[model samples]
Target: MVSLDLRRLRFLREFEERGTLGAVATALGYSPSTVSQQLALLEKDVGARLFEKAGRGLRLNDAGHLLAQHARVLLSAAEAAEADLAALGGDIRGTVRAGGLQSAARRLLVPAVARMMAEHPRVRVEVFELELEQALPGLRLGAVDLVIGDEYDGHPRPRPAGLRFTAALEEPIKVVLPAAHPLAGAGRPVPIARLRSDIWTASAEGTGHHAMVVGTCRALGGYEPDLRHRSNDADVQLELVRVGAAVALMPPLALPADDPAIAVRDLAEAALRRRLVTVTRETPPAPALTAFLRAVTDQARNS
Candidate 1:
């Protein structure tokens, strides 16, 4: 008779997602030794070696992989049952963990949180500020209940299994320059080639924004930009442009609708735009998470 402890199974699932005892410990707020001990106990109960050494860390073996799959189903069932039981008591509330990019958090997620708090006081929501690389994995692994991610025009991201994506908003990716720049008041779509000599600021390397900026310049403008500053924060990029240090490529949500210090212009290429999407698990969402999703989409659409 196998009576697997749900808590131990949770540690296994976290290990599968995070890839190490130390990481699982950090995420679950437990010590590394404690995680190791619990996992060892799980092996004893299952009567099989679930983990094998991979360099300095541990990885799931065939047996471990099989059980981890079962663990996922069991955990999801447990969570659904818990939510249903809570609902029967006239309380439809559960903590929803959400992750998003910096701009999405500022523009959509924070407003949605406020709406959720005011309307459904009992449903708690936690926000994690993460980029697409970090947020999507967390959502697929059940660490986050919802994610707000961005997509560029040419570089589409692969959707992981058991996740659903819904487009929420689309905004043009505009060229931002100092108000004093010669092309600031050009009164037309700014010719990207004209700005080839100007220094540029954009999101850090390996991000979609970096690729978009570099690719757009090379493909359309016919010259590589003198990229001087790198930052993921929209405000930092805009500040550099506002102070005449560097120009930037930014979407409308990244800055104030109208700022006198900076001039926003459409690129000569009309197809340059950013798409924001909400990503979630394919499973049926609990009542609170459903409401939170509604709040996020409504805020995104109305904003």
Candidate 2:
């Protein structure tokens, strides 16, 4: 095996994405001939065929793909090394953008943001409300710096290429009911089966959360309760419960206050616990992100 360069692997990726060397040169501000020369040097140095011609396009062979994967890791490490060097100086200033699902923003991120602001005054953080899948792609495309997401509704898989994540917390789903409701005041732990008659004010149809709730109810010998209304907002769901419109499923973390209006009933099995994670394409997270995740993780622990 010959000595390979990160620059060459980067070129191959750009070539694959761009589909032409001339376009890669134009985008990279290098002449076409210089791009070709660098690639030739790279190929000779590596001693493996990096790409093959397919009509007017170039595609990576198996070895080239594997090398590209490793190249990404090396380039990321190099970038982090540079950032670490820069951070040794007095001033550490940059923006970290993040996105998460609506529930996380309401129950987790808002407090996390407050703590982050108090601790890291110099760093600006902007958090957006988005679904997990929506946030994951942005983390990959470099559109957002971090994503707070969940894995529930029975999804368990390897992380996508070029991204990393930290497990923040595992929150269980609770059954919410009006305080004066039939099962709320019952002494010896109200049976989960009794929940079927309650009109459930749930999230919209076809979402993972909704599916999970429905699946759990069915599994535990409960009738899929009447879904009178659908909403993603915890506050609104609480209001519906207060008005006796319906009951709602809530995470234990987002349990409503002991209002005469609502009671949170913890479920039976651990299978309903939703795992929340913070993700980034950055090999090493920005300082702001680290601090924020730490605070939220601590909060999650306490909760």
Candidate 3:
């Protein structure tokens, strides 16, 4: 009989998701040596060679990939069973691990958590500020129960397999200029092409924000933006604009309702927007999970 340990199976799945033993260890709060030892034990139990040396690191072989597929199913089943048992108790009391982008985490998630805690005193929510790239993986790997992500115009998020996505809010992506800039008080929609010579600040490369800024500029502005700064934080980007250092493009959720230091303007292009979404696994939700999700959705609606 093949006696498989669920913990070892989890380590295997984590390694598959993370693609590095060090990444698995860091994410799970274990040491690399411990992950290696458990995976070795799993291979021994299954009586198969699951890994092969690829340069200086280990890579999963065919058998390993097959086993990892099974591992995901088994882990999901176990989680469903846990949820079922928790439901039998008829109490909305459990920890809901949530992840979100920085702006949504502050604007929506914080108030949602407060409301959930007040209504369901036994429910505890832990929040992690994560970008869409990090949030999706964490949701698939069972690290987070819910994710609040933003999709920019023309940079649609990939459809998450085995997950449910719900649209929360859609807001315009506005341009920010220094108050002293010539177009700062321009009452009409500012043409992007008009700012070709201005230095700009955008989120870091590879993020949707960066991609959208570069793509929009090229397609609409007819010139590449002179990007002088890169940051994922909205406050930092706004500060750069406030100091007359650079102009920025950002969603309204990321902008303060009242900031006199910077001028916010609509882009000449129509329907340039960002859509905020809620993502979760397709598994049956527990009472706590349902309640927490409702709280978040309510906050989004109110915002």
Candidate 4:
């Protein structure tokens, strides 16, 4: 009878999902050499070649793919067993790792952590600020027990198998401008066509927010924006707007608490909004994670 190591099986599953040794290492918090060695050992144990060179990168061969399909079931069963044990323990006393985008972390996750600390003192919550690209992969690899993710209008993200998502909030995206700007006090939804001549600041290209801004502008104004600055930091974008350097499209949660120099207005032509969600694996979540999710949901609803 052959015995397979669950840890190495997990590594293979992560590699199959992530498609690279470096990504697997980052997701599992292991060195690249270690991931490679473990997978090699797994191949030795199974008496088959699992990986093959694909140009400069490595990809799983047919045998590896077949093994990985089985590995998913085994890993999920292992997780289910662990969850059962946690349920039997009857205490939310374990660590729950979570990740989210910047604005969500500040507005949603921080409050959730406070609630978790106060209500479930024994549970430890570890938080990481990660964009959707990194967060989703981390969630699939079991590095993150929960992820706060966003989906913009007209930019739906594909949901991978073995994960569950629950909607937290849906808030409009507003056009942020300098307080002294001419249209700052419009007191109504500002049309994007009116801002065509204005210099724009947006998230870096290829990001979901950036795509939404570009798409909304092109649809409403009939021309591409004069994008002068690009950044992922909402605070930096708001600062640029405050200094009269550029105008930006931003979600409400990204706004500073009391920035008198920034004015936010909804877009009349295209009302852009993003849906925030909490993501977890399909298996029964740990008690601490479930508690954290409840806290986050409550905070999001009240906010």
Candidate 5:
């Protein structure tokens, strides 16, 4: 008899994550008494203490830690097997949860979802409008099965511990300005170095793109821009520019759909490309997810 029951393993994982039995019970929709009894049964079968009291809460013992590690893998395998079985049937089918940046969701991801549904009626794809920072954590936690994320110039891409990534699109850095701004209709692209004194809004601090934009400006004979605004939201930053509030820089893919007051211009600075990445766990991408990513990438590339 295996001590590794799915229910017990799930309870242990939930307990470790929640830090209290009450929270675990709430999450699993079970009473505290039932949870305690099940854990006792699991411990008896394993012949080891699974946890020890730590202040007001329980912490996993060494044996529990060991078992917890395997539990994640086992849970993943079970899901993988189910996905495999679904693929074996005629149409690729299953629910796939993906997360990505706002523009990608608005511009690129919804189109992808429509195509996925048309191609496989049985498959369901869910998209979360998220920042890339949130997507990485979710992928690691097995919360999202895939992510459409972007990588910028300076920061290293996360090799999500046990995931593979591929390029979905390459985004170019662009200078966004109000239609009335002097740079809006320039026939030739302006060098970043020449725009030193332009009032500027920037991406939120600490992001790879944010750092790249600042670093590029400094390297190109530009000093720190007169900081007008800082935000992770590209559309908001662009709106600030659209109203002639300030000029902001962004990747072309992140531009808003329509703005009579706004115009996007390519930055001719060398090596200024950013990559959009499709991230998936090391466990093979279920066919439905694969089809969705591939179809979206192709559609986005062509259109």
Candidate 6:
């Protein structure tokens, strides 16, 4: 009788989700040739052809699909079993693979990780900086165990099945300007229309923040912004504002404490805010993950 290898099944499932052996290898920290060799060995062990050539690439055959479906269940069960064992041991110890946007990584995740390291010395965490769009699919594909993301008031992300979301923080989005700018010392909330003529800096197109900036300007000012600079880096945006090159809309969480060269003001609309959320699979979380999540929430509250 032939036995199935869980590691190979994991590779197969990753291949199914990623649509390429190279992607699977990258996610799993293996070489492409190793991934191909392992899959070929799996096919031999199962006595079936698992993949077939399609144009310039390879795709899973019917047998591969069926096995991959079972692999999902088996892999989930394996995780469940590990969780059970960890619970029995009564010690929060394990490695957690997590990912998040750059702002969250700096503001919330980094501090939380520090606290976790001080408290649970045995728990390990690996973090990746990923865009919100990429992070969600990474969760589904098992490339990341947890993810942190943002949701604006008007733009809601699509929540895929078999996942959980926990709200960590909610803060208003503010307009940022150089300290020497005319509007910096304005005693009242800054109206969107007031900055219509000023050059702007924002995240690149296709990002949620860019859409928010454009949509808000169109709704309030009746004109599109002259976006002169584009970057996803919060510090870079703030720097642009500090140098009087451009103004931008930014969240409070992304700001540094008491910067002398920059000023932040509330939007006149008062309804533009974003929620920071932590996402994980629906399965019972390990103790380390539970602890890490708690730490992240605490950090957000304190920040």
Q: Superposing all C-alpha atoms, what RMSD in Å does each candidate have to the true structure?
A: 3.0, 7.8, 2.4, 2.2, 5.0, 2.8
For candidate 2, which ten residues in a row score worst on lDDT?
134-143
**Preferred candidate (TM-score higher): 2 or 3:** 3
- Higher-ranked by TM-score: 4 or 5: 4
Task: Supply candidate 5's per-residue lDDT for 182.
Answer: 74
Q: How much lDDT does each candidate structure score?
A: 0.86, 0.70, 0.88, 0.88, 0.76, 0.86
Which stretch of 10 consecutive residues in model 3 shows the poorest summed lDDT?
Answer: 132-141
Q: Which structure is stronger by TM-score: 3 or 5?
A: 3
Superior by TM-score: candidate 1 or candidate 2: 1
lDDT tens digits, residue span 126-177, model 4:
9888877777766776778999888898999888899998899999989888
Per-prediction tally of clashes: 0, 0, 0, 0, 0, 0
Instruction: Give the runs in model 5 whose Cα sits over 4 Å from its true position.
Output: 1-61, 256-260
Off by over 4 Å in 6: 14-41, 53-57
Collision pairs in model 4: none
**In candidate 3, which residue ranges exceed 4 Å CA deviation?**
1-3, 14-34, 44-48, 54-57
Ten residues in sequence with the least summed lDDT for candidate 1: 133-142
Assess every candidate by TM-score: 0.86, 0.68, 0.91, 0.91, 0.78, 0.87
Write model 1 residue lDDT over 1-303, tens digit each, in one string: 887988788888878878999887766657999999999999999888999999988899999999999999997787678667766777668899988889999989999999998999999899978777666645655678998888888877788767898999998889899999999885578989989999999888888889889988998899989998999889999889989999988888888888899999888855688999889888778888889999999998897
User: What TM-score does structure 1 among the candidates reach?
Assistant: 0.86
Instruction: Please rank every candidate by TM-score, starting with the best.
Output: 4, 3, 6, 1, 5, 2
Largest TM-score belongs to which candidate?
4
Whole-model lDDT, candidate 6?
0.86
Model 2 per-residue lDDT tens digits across residues 158-265: 587677777888876677778788877653344557777778776666555676667667777457767778876667778988888887667765565567677777
lDDT of predicted model 2: 0.70
After superposing candidate 4 on the true structure, give the runs of residues whose Cα lies further than 4 Å from its correct spot: 1-3, 18-34, 52-59
Q: Which residue pairs clash in candidate 1? A: none
What residue pairs clash in candidate 6, if any at all?
none
